[model samples]
Target: MLKIEGLNVYSDNKKILENINLEFEYGKLYLIFGASGSGKTTLAKAILNDESLKKEGKIFLDNIDITNEKTENTSNIYFILFRILLK
Candidate 1:
């Protein structure tokens, strides 16, 4: 299971994700949906420890802490983003 506990995110001195907690089970498909600029991608980036925002929390991979730490090969949890062009 992938668990995020007490997650809070900040960017440019503004709050993004606040005290958010989530759990994702293995072998199950999940979706993170929201309107534009609602921190959907930000949450995904934070899980992968992206270098664009600041976060405070603990992320667990099967109950192992993986927060702010370098992971050897964390390809198990993956994310894909789709975009549509309107003319």
Candidate 2:
């Protein structure tokens, strides 16, 4: 199971995400959707441990603290982003 507790993300002293909490269970499918500029990408970046953004709180994968873990280390986890192109 993957869990997030009190997750907050900040960019250049500006708060992008505040006090967010989420959980994902094994063998389950989840979706995150929102309007543009609603911090959706920021949340994904935080989960992937992006160093460019400042983050607070804890991210856990099966009871392990992965808040600061490198993405390379978590080979089993995958993140997919889809973009729509309009002509």
Cα lDDT listed for each candidate? 0.73, 0.80
lDDT of 1 at 7: 97
Q: Model 2 off-target regions past 4 Å?
A: 79-87
Q: How far out, in Å, is residue 58 in model 1? A: 0.9
Summed backbone clashes in each candidate are 0, 0
Which ten-residue region of model 1 has the weakest summed lDDT?
78-87
Give the C-alpha lDDT of model 2. Answer: 0.80
Q: Which candidate is the best by TM-score?
A: 2
Task: Kindly list the per-residue Cα lDDT of model 1 for residues 1-87, writing each as its tens digit.
Answer: 778999998888688999989987766667889899998988877887875678898888778787775423343434221111111
Task: Tell how far residue 5 is off in model 2, in angstroms.
Answer: 0.1
Question: What lDDT tens digits, residue by residue, belong to model 2 across residues 47-76?
Answer: 888888999999997799989998666533
Candidate 2 TM-score over all chains jointly: 0.83
